[model samples]
Target: MNESTELGEDFKCKLPNVSMSTQSKTMPMIDLKVYIRVVAAVFSISSATALVMALLRLLTPNLFYVEPLDGSNIVLHYFITGLMVVTSAIGLLNSCVVMNRSAAKNTGRNITTWLLLDSLFETTRVVYVFICEVVIKGRGSLQTYEMLISIAQYLLDSFLYCQMILRH
Candidate 1:
């Protein structure tokens, strides 16, 4: 019996990092949930800020465009900015869902879905802004700074989501 006790101790000690036995008593369930929440929170806040910027551009049309060159651009801007507002609001709600510890277990799928949707929005918005920056404003428009920021944010978020997806 003494030898058996020693063997059991050795087994526990040799267990891998994710051993439920090891982490269960220590942290319970804060590990994955907290990290996921943090990521989602960042995504939410950034999306909100994007929403604001889009709204401002929509409100001040001439401020974004030097001249009223075409009707198609005005419509496209209106449509894309509206999408940004809706998607960002959903993204913010998703963050709140992940932040609540008692909400649900096995939320990996749901969170992944949200992240995928956010990724799509982020990528598409950056592309749309870039095309407008180059074609409409010669790449040095008033929205240039916002466009650059969006590009950087999208790249970072894409990398993080990719890593998280791979882990799960």
Candidate 2:
């Protein structure tokens, strides 16, 4: 055998050098739809929990020994909290829609507006709650820990929705 043949045989066990093809950097599965769906699920759950807690407090006012709060203020509180509940429900539905679309491998752009609106609505609710909680004078017992938690859920949902717009 020639010197070249012997050299090739000596390196027969080595693999041939194959250059990697250039692949366009695209968003991974977990980055966009998957990530937002997961966040949406958690956001939905948090909203539901906060809703239940707020309802419990509202129904059982005597449990906390809350003094008689202003009727108008109570009405406003219920209105905002109820709006939050509806917002959370919508978020949950949006997540389900996203999951279905993802399973079909065809996520659409329709949800972008909904997500943006949810973020705005939730932010408004959270801000209202924060302002009320700070400005209100004497309904300390009614505004229990659950109120803060409920507000937190709204905040989290708002943040998630805002983030989802970018991903969507």
Best by lDDT: 1
Q: Positional deviation of 93 in candidate 2, in angstroms?
A: 3.1
Highest-scoring model, TM-score: 1
Report the CA-based lDDT of candidate 1 relative to the real structure.
0.69
Put down candidate 2 lDDT per residue, 52-161, tens digits, no spaces. Answer: 64465456645433465477766766665566566656655655565556444525555665465456546655654564466443245555665667666766776766
TM-score of each: 0.69, 0.58
Which regions of candidate 1 are displaced past 4 Å? 1-30, 101-103, 138-141
- Model 1: pairs clashing at backbone N, Cα or C within 3 Å: none
Model 1, span 35-138: residue lDDT tens: 67777777777777777777777677666676774777667777776777677667666666666645365276776677777777676677657656765662
The C-alpha RMSD in Å for every predicted model, in order, reads 8.1, 9.5
Quantify all predictions' global Cα lDDT against the true fold: 0.69, 0.59
